[model samples]
Target: MSRASARNVLLVEDDTAIATVIIAALEDEGFKIEHCTSVAARDGWLRGHAFDVMLTDVMLEDGDGLASLDSVRKAAPDMPVIVLSAQNTLDTAVRASDSDAFEYFPKPFDLDELVQAVQQACGGSGSSANLPDEPDDDGMPLVGRSQAMQSVYRMITRVLRNDLTVLVTGESGTGKELVAEAIHQLGSRRSGPFVAVNTAAIPADLIESELFGHEKGAFTGAVAQAIGKFEQANGGTLFLDEIGDMPAEAQTRLLRALQSGRIRRVGGRQEIAVDVRIVAATNRDLVPMISAGTFREDLYYRLNVVPIELPPLRDRREDIDVLCQHFLSQAVEEGLPRRQLSADALEKLRGRNWRGNVRELRNVVYRLALMARDDVIDPGSLADIIGDEQLPIGQSGDVRTSGIGQALETWLAAENPSAGSVYSQAIAAFEKPLIEHALGRTSGNQLRAAKLLGINRNTLRKRIGELGIEPDRFARPL
Candidate 1:
């Protein structure tokens, strides 16, 4: 029979409503639609007759849609299988593509486009060659298969369903703010604004004004009535980053805001009722700070209502390959040439102690894309960009020497003669360049730079003073 005259399609969908809608749409296009809700029925129907194309949901009551795809491909190798799923992510997209599926449609997709994709898979004149590409608007979501990240995803989904306060704790480069943004996106308040404030980045005197806003005459620089993050994020999410670095006064006021759901301007007495979900993040161990009396224990409990901990990248090395591919795809979407990592380069990445975690990996990949001359990224190219001295011992043949201890010893012997004073200078030298490098990377955005360096902005400021590095030097020119 001719191709157009014999277009038979099998659609496996668990939702009866969705199946009815899709079947009506496909049937209208002059193709026969055979519907099945379970894999057993789908297999039975496949055995009875040949199908030109197959459409299956990723999840069903009996089995996964990919399994159905496998069965169809085995029985009819030429038949095209399209996967429909609500769980839209890079990892899922890649999996579908690698499985030789013809296309993928994320949920809430346009019916017209899906029909067209089906047509194309069946070799129709107006059919698309591949599934509609995943949207490239946002940068890639955090991709991982490791248990650590899986747990993190689960906790984020659970916390996003409510307005309870959240505290995200992790090492500096572990993408704490990304977790907060994910929570906001997945929550009921997705349409609401997501306002973020870095407590440590603001000056101690100005923190109050920054968090609670200020009246026109609040202070010398307060020329107009300013709105704070709390007010701006009203009815949404307010992410307080580096909460541990907040000044005692600011901490007290923040506690009041969390407790009362209200705020008063710096120079105004009226307490304005506000509704905002609070998500706080910190690299510091709050338990220690609470014991030391620097952090309020009550505030800790309030913010820790739903605690989410992000494991450092080193702890989840299994995710490095997936993350690398995800980032490479991101770079390509951003107008850079697409590239793949060589096996050696990928192995090196897996072996490294990722102190900076995901953030550092992103930077490394971006740098490699810019510096690599060829389409494939080799180990040498990656090493050159991330610096060879930072490579793991087994790969580089160099003894592991990049640590605070080694830095301290070098500084003590070279710069300080008196043992008593050596400790201070050693600490300064070890910290100064790291802060400077992070500042340079972020163009002196103290908040982001502080997160990258794994130090509180207040501590960064103190070190800036001790190192005699002017903050203005690192500031970007407007």
Candidate 2:
């Protein structure tokens, strides 16, 4: 370890206690510490001296420390800046990343993490450039509270300020486009347009011309010069969805563009420089594609610089209730009648296999809002809406498609709750959907349901009252 006198650390923190603790910790680790209470003092110190690293708190007594990031970059481009802030939301994290912070610590952070970051910085020569100032925070559309989702959020936040290519992998309808849009909207390139191209959706022959543009008379149908997605997305983000399907010729050109930061129009000689960020998404496994000679392994490495793997909806079932509510609100905004899901209805939704992930869930919510007879959606209405969407089972013969037993097993595994009420809970789960389904089919006529269910009408009414089943909702319209 170097002597404390040989290395200097500039710390800008308004809180006296935090500053003292941080200063003491760095000094013990053989680092010389220079403390500033506000951005004003930091600016004054920036003129005459340089430091090994900088530790800054976003909020300060005089002005925000984050706003002074440009000054630090200007004064010493190679000095790494670690941000500390009490504002621990995603917005703050993204902003810290946008400013090209070496590391960011929320207030009440682990001191050991900070120490390790500083030690790493001290041993290395920092060369990454400062990121341009980013736009105001635009909330991301990603909806989930599971640990899996949290990891995705962290990765997104880390890449917001950089031009690094990101490869998002997940099943279809897992909102890969949503992830791409969020990164573009929240990053320095928000002022630029976001262009998206689905590689799989386009024909094989036209993929290159579609992405790299074409000059007049380039091909048989080239009557005029046309801008490609690469040129159109210059200074912004280009989302290449389903990249695993990109043709070999286009993949070769894409690799060239990525390497040279330039694109050449079809049938034209000039190399046009473009300042675009690429975000690619695919459901197919690229490793297998590479092995099969479908996807280029070299190109895959270039695009997979930062990989964000989104967990399927089934893996994050804890988010289903919130997602349903979010979709319900979106429906109301779009002139649909307001609708709320009953507890049992939400439970039913949580229990299903979301083969289509968030997209399928949104469709079900919209259908329930449109077709359900009442404002409060019950388990029966949801079941009916979702049942209509059951996709044909594939070769895997997934057990989730078999019945509600799969859903209950998943819920039971997650809960591992007391076994005493397991029988009752299981019975209620089956009974509510069945009884309400019968009531809906019979136009809410108890006698008809009793006959259909092979039970006494009095007994049917008793079960209806016990389950809080609103039979009126299932009555046929006049």
Candidate 3:
């Protein structure tokens, strides 16, 4: 690029280390660099000079970077702004796009990519209509800075402007309802009431009346007219939780209402029009249910118009530290004394696999805040609390006995054995199921079962002999 036509780049960043690296790269590209450390300084510079492209950070010494970008948007609508943020949440990315910034870059960002964005931004273009950022006071309730959560945030933002039905799928305790509430709170119908009905919680006989309302004296117990969830959620969003558990009869009624955009009371004839956005969530796999003819395929199609899959906490270990801090802050606000987690304790938390996802983590944090004596939670304190908590397993087994420790404890509590033999008995009790499960999973192929068990085939064979496990029962017959 020639000096005469070289672009002017304004960088608003506070960290000197990051600024130095950015300035060196941009200056070497022949662009004139003007640095501003705070939003106040940036405003003054904006008043004095015209820049070809602007790069700003989310956090500055004086004010929030994303919030301040609105000024640049108004002052020089045509000058493209590239937002760099260390706050790599979905909210940050959405706010950047809403501000009409040319592009958004998460920190530890690739410099080569930033350069490309600046180069593209330098190409002159007129201002576009502005999208107002979400209110500062209304922070993102769902917390996670991982890339997985970022994808979820982007999806939430996309569907916020529309009334499209959304289906949120994740394991239990992954905050499915929270996602539903976020969409309702942030979407165009923020003022409307959000009514959530759990399909599984309601009895099968009452689901119809629970959702579609009923006329007075409609049934044996119907003394008065009842307004159902669909009508209650009028002009807003209706969240149907555990939708897979909705009985077949209720599923039919729901599908009909979704298709026609109208509903009739359980025992009344007049069709009532309901302008409700449906957001359904389920932990069960609807596809398999559809195949089994239990869950309605049509209803699945209707609610799945916009699908949001929330990742479980175990998959996003990067977020564990932040989540723990958030829960700890919450506990403090709710009357617990302020407490902090030691670095070692946080690392230990990050290393463990959370079966209950965010909910489980929150519970542990709350427990620690209330029970732990130390102001700073250390590994020892964390271990004592965590060790007492039972590790949950998959749906295939009973949770109480599924965990090795829990199973051993249950056995010892029941049997009065010689203290010496109790240890061996417990070991055998734990190993039996584990080896059986491995054999079952591998169809009794010793080599495959050994691999699954992470042990040598010979060791596995020896263990089978010692434990008296009948591997032949599980073996695939010739």
In terms of TM-score, the best-performing candidate is: 3
Colliding pairs, model 2: none
Residue 223 CA displacement from its true place in model 2, Å: 1.5
Instruction: Predict model 2's lDDT versus the native.
Output: 0.81
Best by lDDT: 3
Regions of model 2 farther than 4 Å from truth: 1-89, 95-134, 388-478
- Predicted candidate 3 versus true structure: per-residue lDDT over 17-79, tens digit per residue: 999999988887778899989999998889889999989998999989887776876777688
**Candidate 1 residue lDDT tens string, 162-271:** 68889999887788998888777656676789999988778899999988999998889788999998999998899999998899988899999889989999999899
> lDDT (CA) for every model shown?
0.76, 0.81, 0.81
Which residue pairs clash in candidate 1? Answer: 120-127
Where does the lowest 10-residue lDDT sum fall in candidate 2?
388-397
Native-to-model Cα distance after best TM-score fit, residue 224 in candidate 3, in Å: 1.2
| lDDT (Cα, tens digit) per residue for candidate 2, span 1-478 | 4444558889999889988889888888888889988887998888898899989999998887887677778888888888888765566766777677888777776777788788877778663555666665644567765657756766887787578999999987898998999888887788999999998778898898999999999999999999999999998999999898788998999999999999999989999999999999988889988999989999999999999998999998988988998899999999989999999988878887775689878976876786566899887655544452243222244546423544355446655667656567556546765787678679999899889999999999989867646576668953
* Candidate 1 vs candidate 3, TM-score winner: 3
Better of 1 and 3 by lDDT: 3
In candidate 3, position 391 carries an lDDT of: 37
